[model samples]
Target chain A: MSAFSTGAVTLAPHRVAAMVLRYLYLLRSSWTRLLELIYWPAVQLLVWGFLQFYIAQNSGFFARASGVFIAAVLMWDVLFRGQLGFSISFLEEMWSRNLTNLMISPLRPIEFVCALMIMSLIRLAIGMVPVTFLAIAFFGFNVYGLGLALAAFFVNLILTSWAVGIVVSGVLLRNGMGAESLAWTLMFVLMPLACVYYPVSVLPDWLQVVAWALPPTYVFEGMRALIMEHVVRVDLMVEAFVLNALYFSAGVVAFLQLLKSARRVGSLLQTGE
Target chain B: MSQAAEPAIAVDQLVKVYKTTRAVDGISFALEPGSITGLLGGNGAGKTTTIAMIMGLVTPTAGTVKVLGAEMPRLRYHVLHKMNFESPYVDMPHRLTVRQNLKVFGRLYAVEDLDGRIAALAREFDLSEFLDRPTGKLSAGQKTRVALAKALINSPRVLLLDEPTASLDPDTADWVRAHLERFRKERGATVLLASHNMAEVERLCERVIIMKRGRIEDDDTPRRLLIRYGRETLEEVFLDVARGRGEAREAAQ
Candidate 1:
């Protein structure tokens, strides 16, 4: 029997909800926090929409595919929001010096991750939805025009971002709060390799090898395929899913391993400092 | 089979070595059910490390920690709901209200009738007025009360506390100690308290374990330790232990 099915061990929904409620209370209590959830994505959308329009008028490549850059920017926010939400939520516990309290509770590592995943989803929706509507109104581009493929691309990209978030959180755990910068920089390091605003072919042959290894590369490439050629690439979606599965597994393993290391070093209690 | 009735907490040869310095050298002790034991030590004496190990927050280098009869860092999940920890060094989310913090912890521990529990704790801790305020805005005494309320949210059988009354004024600190005494009497909880306040230990702890250089130097009741060191108070006994006079006394004995 699975751990969840057995009475011996199971992820308590109430405990997970408590974790989620903790973050919700923070968001609800602070107007700045609530504003922050939507501010950056809206600014990014407006700025990127103007850039896309400028490029579309001046650049021959973008002129032919007017919506590609706008679409890419909106889609990329999904990934960025996913990674930031997960890592920042974890950082909140450290900043508050509440990790020791949570660790000592009956909440399991997997359950904690699950809570962060839920929080990331809430953050992503709060951050991205308004911006997405702005993209349509301002750029004359609706990423939703990609239809059902947008959902597939979104799931793959967010899951891949979650994988990156897990690895960064592991770094924070194994090291200390000094490594917090990794939470913001780790995903952007993959941006060039992810080919977020460009196609994989634009990169040199050697770098293209690295790009192809990333799940987001397939996602953006698939986005370009749908936007530029109106072709749905099933193979790219499959490749992204397979790679996401592997990266997520490795990320979880790395996170759990680092948690054990942190415990051995007694860093869990001293994390905030 | 005969070891089935394990004490509330049992540490066997617990050791935590950090690179070169041994934070918690080989040590062993146990706390009987419903007893409040003080773990006393000076700076760098490993009281926090020992308490962390007992709470399964730190993995011992070469020993076992069994809490509530389950080997820790392994079966910690099985008994975690039955154990809770509190420390003034840690804080709850600053943006959360005191009541929200308590509610979060109460739900996490799956305490039944959580609203009732929070109301009761707020009344008991005199937290009703400030419970609606953000935790960061509360005074230190109020925050301490909230922390203690969070610790007891689970009504845990084993409670690990580190300087539970570190910075409070004399009257508030005394009140906190009295409440802890009431908690022990009412709940029959096993407490492993780590503190530098000798009077607090002397008053609340039935037995005291004095530690130095990551090892236990003496384990005795407050009265016995005072007699053994020819000291009038536990503070004097603590001073002698911290100054390494306990070793000299042992040699002379």
Candidate 2:
């Protein structure tokens, strides 16, 4: 009999839930924490909502697709909150010096990743649901109007965020909290390249080549297609999914390898700001 | 093999090199079941690294670590639930109450009757008053008690402790030590304690392993260590090891 057979299922749901419960307890304890999750998304929505209103009245080009900016802002927060959600959960363990404790627990690394992913979804919902409603209320843009296509976009963008979040977490593991800024700043580097506010054709030929290589490029292109042309680009969504799969796998591998290196270098206990 | 015949913890030529420094250098030892071993060392002497390796928190560069018949970090999950560690340096989430913190840990350990366990630990640690208070609001002594409660949440068979009583007053420290002794007696748990308190080591540990510069300088009981080093106390013996007088004494002998 194998020694590990006793608990050798690939995933243990209770263990994953335990970690989720830990973060939930933390979230409920502080009202500021609960507010902070919703605060930034709401502020971003309002700022962009008024700006979109001004442009729609002034520019015929925007009047034809007035809801584009609101939709973009809402989806972008999905990506941001998803990534931040994951990184914050991991960082909370580090700041408290509890990573070592969790590492030594029976919870597997994969289970920990699952917990991060689940918490990411929870935090994303907490931050974005209100902002989406605000978008409809303030700018008359119903993000949900995209119907099933909205889900494809959300999934692709959030997958890409997890990929980036995992890689950022890896860098923090290898380099310590000095690299903590990467968690917040890294995803923005992809925003312009993602063509969030404009069509891919707006970019110069050389930059378009680089933009097409990203998963989000396909997502935004698909988003604009659904809004402006009233056409669903299943082909673009498929391409985004394929690209997200590759990046997310690479991210997971990089994280596990970095954690191994940390163990070899004895840095797990020393991880702190 | 029978449980008594097999070692609870077995380390063989374990080495961990962190860049240029060898944090743990080819150390080897074994602990019989239910034994308390004091792992004593000065600053940068590899005690913490060794404990981390045994807990499967650190990987060995060379050789192996076996806890309860499973290789460390590789097959750690097979036996992880059977082990737990406590350290003053590691903190539970501060915003979580003492009770909430206990609940989280109990859930992670998959403890059965978790509410009952928390209640028992709270009463045993005299934490009933502070159970609902934020853990960060507690005094240093109160926090240490809570940390101990968290460590024992799993009722682990192997316990690794690093400076388990660093910040408590003398009276509380004595009380904590007494409880630890009682815990080991009642559970028959194997404890590997890394502490700077020589008196605590002498009073509780059946065997002592003295390390210096990532090596085992001496391994014996406190009484034998005192006689061999011609010292009056384990603290003097520890100083001799830390100061490199151990080699001189061995050479003179």
Kindly list the per-residue Cα lDDT of model 1 for residues A1-273, writing each as its tens digit: 113635644677778888999999988887888789899988888888788888878889888898888888888889988999999999999999899899999888888999999999999988888888888788788877788999999999999989999988888988989999999888888889999988888999999999999999999999999988989998999999999999999999999999999998878877998
Per-prediction TM-score to the true structure, in the order listed: 0.97, 0.97
Provide DockQ values for all models, in the order shown. Answer: 0.72, 0.68
lDDT of 2 by residue, A160-241 (tens): 9999989888888877898899998998998999999899998999999999999999988998899999999999999999
Clash count for each candidate, listed in order shown: 0, 0
For the predicted complex of model 1, DockQ is 0.72
Worst 10 residues of 1 chain B by lDDT: B1-10
Clashing pairs in 2: none
Q: What is the TM-score of chain A in candidate 2?
A: 0.95
lDDT of 2 at A13: 79
Q: Give the fraction of true interface contacts kept by model 1.
A: 0.95
